[model samples]
Target: MAPAITLAAEAPKLSSANTGFMLICSALVLLMTPGLAFFYGGMVRVKSTLNMLMMSFISMGIVTILWVLYGFSLAFGEHNSLIGWNSDWFGLSHIGLTELWPGYSIPVFVFMVFQMMFAIITPALISGALADRVKFSAWSLFIALWVTIVYVPVAHWVWGADGWAFKLGVIDFAGGTAVHINAGAAALGVILVIGKRVGFKKDPMRPHSLPWVMLGAGLLWFGWFGFNAGSWLGNDDGVGALMFVNTQVATAAAMLAWLAYEKIRHGAFTTLGAASGAVAGLVAITPSGGAVSPLGAIAVGAIAGVACAAAVGLKFRFGYDDSLDVVGVHMVGGIIGSLLIGFFATGKGQSAATGVFYGDHTFTQLWKQCAGVGAVLAYSLVVSAVLAFLLDKTIGMRVSEDEEISGIDQAEHAETAYDFSGAGGGVVGSVSASALATAAQTKKVDA
Candidate 1:
């Protein structure tokens, strides 16, 4: 007003081709939810299939709503290192905001919706590690709290306009450390606190369906093109094309490595193993892909596959039942990718700050990466714990023993997924029946 109320000039417009590309990328990412459903559904008992599917589907709804409200602004808005306190709920009412942010072709609001999908899937991915137990109310609350407390800050720290890591030149082209490693550690924390499911090591808790897992893997793989490629903000850039190539290269390598490992260790490459391997590869290359060469991505994928395989067996050693090995795949994969960038990433003049394999400032890059890992892990763990504590104290976490004995689908949702032959119901079927059977035998022996 003092300056005559002159408005800033309108933002420049992106070409139509670029806008089309971004929209396609957005749609591709939207596919990840169903892919996630298949991934988790295959690992869980048949009795809890619907419950597992719901965990992923629910995220598509809850996170989208939350993202529109404040998650996006908090995550991507123009605030400081820790968090963004700009734009109240849905404050970004305009479209095609190129003047404010030059690189993106799409409106900030559209970009927010697109990234919202990422925020949704990352938390849902962790749910795999907690399958078959945990109340829906509690699960919903856990996710809501975890995303707000752990995910938003970590996301801002890594990708926000004022993120310190971005300023310090930590190249996370996608989200190796932020989404994969962050979720993996948080998964471990929650599983530790909640304890194991009823029949963890002793029971033959094999996946009820392998086809579902493969399907999920397939879906996740397809969607990753968007997850990695979309990071470019628009398709016009060469970096975006490179990211697309890396996504494919890493996923394929991970698949081959995982199958070979399974063939050696378990005597056959199971469908579940293949699906898991693909995901592991995707996680590993997320942070380093666009910055590195094809060879680098392959190396990253191969090592991530092997390392995640080894880590998955740690459940027997460390005694923390990471029910679906979220800790193994995502955490280890993220670490591998984060560390690999030190040895792999190079520019036109690789001589100046070259990786060790190229013989330069390799060790320095690795050290910075480790620091970032430590910060993200510590922050996620502590914040997740605090949030879990608050929710538990305030509204109560964990279902009752009775609910525990029954499948969450029936206990929490008041419905069962498959009533194949009128055998499944609220209390007289599936998990409930199993619990009752166990109780009756115990009573008989005692009597």
Candidate 2:
């Protein structure tokens, strides 16, 4: 009885406040996946809407199961620098209910679930670039593999206790390197292997629904407070508050900058531009928010907004078909954000590291940031390309050209985003099979 009493007394007292806060934050972060579904869903052509939504939705399902089984272990378990594992972490079977994450007030379960949400969304982000053409089965398999191969290692490198990058003093407040950059680079790699969409530059592939895009952007903005501030793991300090403020400041600044750039370069501001800009700002602030002041966040956001705006157009010049600008926005935004940390860090936020603008005259932090970015970019690009190439040669990554033209939703999922049959509209289910075939043929001819 005395020994048990002594052990209990020595155990860290659990803070209900922190636990509740993290639960709410985890819920918020989970919402971002559905938000991303709408974001990506609305960006693709109507023919591919449901398929696009499914791509994001499927990750939620696939990753949840994997996380419980071995994903969490590989990402956060105690192990080597490159990867982590503990047999007990498998199935979360060995963790005690009251066992707090070391140095934190929340239980290991809360932290694990929160990190799981990140794992779910990262691979989903890749689906955006392969929007209209990839086989759904192939994509699901890719997510499973990519998470195991790419995401787990990178997450360990950046966030795990003994990760090489984390030990080296790289700063990734949320997931600029692990989530955004990893997904973006993977998107680029897969598209390169799978080749261009059937029509490529000759077709008019505008977004099908701007309202959905705006709604998605709004939801993502709402959820990101948790994604950023909650990363601090507790509200016991002013750092979480600082992160929260920087997220909003940077997002607004980026949106305005993107709109300004759009007006100047394209002679008009667009809803897509507004949403994309907001996201770019969000991405930029993700890695730097913990380290930069609100003012520095503005710089990060503005720079990312303008840079990503310019980058989205490069696919056309380079002749790669990124279906929805995933490469330009996420990859470019992540790089801009990660590197800017070297210039904007205040040495007072989450860590004591100062940036070039703040007293570090040696550019050491910048080089470190570059190294993190370069390593993630190179590894993800090469490995993802290899994965896609292998899948392409074996099971095939793309649907047939006819299926793509006819609509991936029908061919892949046998469904559509909207039903127009009741109103006598000419959309999918409203028409006879032969008529639908004719329309598909017409679309191919038009393209």
Best by TM-score: 2
C-alpha lDDT of residue 115 in model 2 = 95
Worst 10-residue lDDT window, candidate 1: 1-10
Runs with alpha carbons beyond 4 Å of true place in candidate 2: 1-12, 423-447
Every candidate's lDDT:
0.78, 0.92
Residue 389 C-alpha lDDT in model 1: 66
* Alpha-carbon RMSD, candidate 2: 6.7
lDDT of 1 by residue, 1-447 (tens): 000112346444555676667677778888988898988888888767888899889888888878877887788776787787565435455444553244444655556666787898889988888887777788897888788888888888887767776556566767887888898888887877777877678887888888888888898999999988887776554778888888899988998899899899989987877888999999998987877788888998999888888889998898888878899999888988888877887752211344557654438776767778888888877776676666667776666666655776787777776675554454466777799899999999999
Let me know the TM-score candidate 1 reaches against the reference structure: 0.87
Best by lDDT: 2
